[model samples]
Target: MAHEKRAYPLWTELPYAGKTHSPTIAGGVEPDAGKWKTYFIQHSRRHGFKKLDGRPIRLAIKDPDSIDWYAQLKVVQHTLENLSDQEKRIAEYWSAGPPTKQWIPIVDRLIDTYAIEAPRAARILSAVFGGMNDAFVVCWALKYKWLVPRPNQLDQHLATYICTPEHPSYPSGHATISGAAEVILSYFFPAERQKLHRLAEENAQSRLYAGVHYPVDNTEGLRLGRQIGRIVIEELKKDTVNGLPIERSSREFRNADIITRTYEQAIPFDYKSKCDSLLIRDDESTGNSSTKDWIDPKLFI
Candidate 1:
């Protein structure tokens, strides 16, 4: 037996987005590519392909090294099958999907209203998303390090709906990504924090419904995401990124809870319909609405 160092195809990368686990060498046999070709030829003969004179025979010879035509298909197929089976077993200790159910409609609304002020809204949303980028990178990197399997393959009782994604299950990427976005947007519009947080939580849970992640994956993932958001906020207070204001004076900032409560009261839940009434009032858009000085470009660390 001989083995080959085959690179996984790019399309397959999506299913196993954060899996970083490497195979164990153990007493694994080294595959012989030449012998593998011979074996495939023999299998083809057994399957009656040898009797074909035209297209089918030509196809087999032309694609002898392809996975479906050869042994790599079996190797990868069984490896994933085993991993999913094991993941299903692990999913039993906890729930298999989103940790909360209350946030779905909230997020649905937010996503529906993702566009508001055209360019300005785009800029604001872009800045908010920038705060989220680091969270996903770190979370996914940690996921690879943790190398936890997902629930679909681990527990027999947990019937996963999505095809098992080929990623490690630890920190849920969806949860962390959504959480970071929520934290940043919530800072800007404090009144919407609960709704935003719920949205984030629900986004994480959708992965479970999608059958690609487990409940614990979202829980841990959300925790990590919030931590990343806090770190980004602190850093923003001291630095600048591409002309976006990151830092604010201590005098201008309010407690997050108070700011959020006031914002919600001011904006109201049905504020979208009255977009005309939601004017900036003053230069709250320019001057520090919270009494904070714009972080000077020089002071940005």
Candidate 2:
């Protein structure tokens, strides 16, 4: 009861935020994101190229029972057991926060890659980030609805590389949001489709390496979030400048067109890691370890 009582409440005020049980969160929903849906300024059906009264497509988070949980746990175990310091660095980076900040560098990189015009850059970011938020709404709802457990709960002796988020672990929030970002961004920059897709895959995998979420959590989150992203992209494509095809100024944006983030200055988090300092195991099979302080991956977080 000691640790259980100490767990944080993500949003107890909202009805859909759900209830907690056994260190597992249930019945999740982000009311703020739902409120975001009413915001038609960016790309809502009411004010976009498409004028449908409802969402383009419904979310598809499957019933938890349908998942092969044992196999899922095995994958999480494998990733944790085989985790390298480099992989841990990547995972810890994402565990910091959601797309609002952690994603700035990636978006900036894309803008630089394509040299996107200022106004147009604004539109792409609006679509990508808006979709990212939408995906979170669906993902969290499914998370609490499923009320899955984190890897640590299943195995008390397990030590996660990052602090586990205080929510159900069925669908990873980072994976879900990143999945949506990849799809929405790809629609704007099809030339970088492979790279964007790879980023999404890595974002999902990072959850496993963190040892906080299971494999299925990531897989399902990505799948569900991708679907949400497609919906947002479909809405973003409707644009015309004097009957000529173009898209931009779909939402608010930073003034500069070629936005770039200095990674050292852009890290969005600053929490201490829950695990020990740097040490690489000599072998995955034998689980032997040595200790040596490694370089901090980022300055801010």
Candidate 3:
């Protein structure tokens, strides 16, 4: 099998970084990537509402020699070559920061939109973050265990649109977190299930558009994340009062709806601009705020 071969380079060097630094086979960034596993191991020792067991969550993936692996690589190459303007925007949008950075704002928006109370909102945040943490832990364990080479590592000629992250590529962190967030948030806000799912799919596909991950990486990450999310939901159900599961009522906030509509109606920002510093300007001629006003201008920088 291709995985057994020692000749093929694994995720060893930073591809996007120029040739100045020495390429040693030492540990890449976040050598302690699997340290989060301890959180689950020590959960019982500490005070917590739910106890999550991550041992049962396993990811089964195709080997590098399989036809499906090569086909997925071809998909990544094709996506990079034929990326549309919208695809490029999507990639750049999700590439702003760590997966959690983007998700925090989304959760906040959902909380505000639904006018959730303090207790329910806290539970929502706890479940979402817990699931994400578990996803990262399990994802990193499999990532370093498999040591799968990234798309660029497989093909040197390929130039990614965004800088590749300094980690082994098999399961995408962004996609995993997106999937986990989607499932948990959907369980809380069933009304926005379809829209939440679309966001998750877009987040997963962004990795492909950026040429950073293979199709299987995103798909498996989503699957793993969803499984972990379901587990989190089940654990949450265990917390009951008076022999019944605790529940909260969510009231719709009309102002949040209007704000969301206005924000979505704003124009998309161009990421290729050559601005020196962060600047927000209004189009006085049209009496409308520019895209920068609506979107996070920091992401462009």
Candidate 4:
């Protein structure tokens, strides 16, 4: 299907044009395919119309510092900006045309029901929902350092989930952040670790699916995420009562336990129940919870 070109707001398109513009309000001008749209739109008005393709937008951010010099070689900012553009495009495409509406209810239900009843589980789900923030931060940080190019610039035939980012590519931040959050959640839900791991991997792969990340960048990001997760797990292990992690005994685990108890198990939280409030305090105080009660194994053991 072909997308008709829509008239974009002038301010929005200027940033996308990647010019040496300071953080100022945009002048009322749209981008022409041939013009350099930056701090000020420079053009050869006197002579016949011409465009200056002097250097890529990414390189112009660099200054003459030792750090800047190393950054030129590394291409950090370039990669970050490129990946960010890719992510934005992916999100926009998905928002414009979602695969289905059915999953939204399911995911929303899962997030709400589990968050209060099972806070840790809620955190896990939340982490999964918009966890890409970390990846974006990483990419933005690196983009300032490195100025690499997307695969599309190198070769046009590469199909992507979103349009290729207009910057450098290295150290896939999406993969790293997604992997980190997944691995951390996995410790609480060990049985589902494999599943979670796959989910994280797929999330990274989605970048590839979107056609923005190279295989190496994504792989490196996943590796970085795993390391981050392991560290988090170690930290959380210390957040326990008598060596037992409190997050494991949270509401989701209890719900899971109730499910296992009987086919006729009652739904846990009712309007008048004090158990809801009780558990909140117990968790806050680092009090030991009995293992025999209904516990979600993914969270506890």
Which structure among the candidates has the greatest TM-score?
3
Instruction: Write candidate 2's Cα lDDT for 113-215 as tens digits.
Output: 6678888788877777767766776665556544566666555455555545555677888788878888887777666667678778877888888776788
- Give the better candidate number (2 or 4) by lDDT: 2
lDDT of 3 by residue, 113-213 (tens): 77789988998888888778876776776667566677766665566666566567778888887888888887887777777788788889988987778
lDDT of each: 0.40, 0.58, 0.63, 0.38
Off by over 4 Å in 2: 1-21, 24-52, 248-269, 273-301
lDDT of 4 at 275: 14
TM-score of each: 0.42, 0.69, 0.74, 0.43
lDDT of 1 by residue, 1-301 (tens): 1225332222112222222332222211121111222111121432322211222222111111222212322332343344443333232111222222222333334434533345445544554565455554455444443344444333322323233433455566667766766776666555567767765775665555434454555666677667556555554444467976643322232223211211122222321111110111224222212232222211110
Q: Give residue 167's lDDT in candidate 1 (0 to 100).
A: 45
> What RMSD, rounded to one decimal, does every model reach?
23.3, 9.2, 7.9, 21.6
* Residue 114 alpha-carbon offset, candidate 4, angstroms: 7.1
The order of the candidates by lDDT, greatest first, is: 3, 2, 1, 4
Candidate 1 regions with alpha-carbon error over 4 angstroms: 1-123, 156-158, 239-301
What is the lDDT for 296 in model 3?
A: 29
Residues 1-301, candidate 4: write the lDDT tens digits: 1214322111122222113331122221111212323211123445312213322112111121212222232342344345544443333232121211212332344345345356665655544333333333333444333433444433323323343333344455566665666676556555445555664675565555444555555666677556545544554556677877666553233222211112121222211211110111123322312211222211110
Cα miss at 200, model 2 (Å)?
0.7
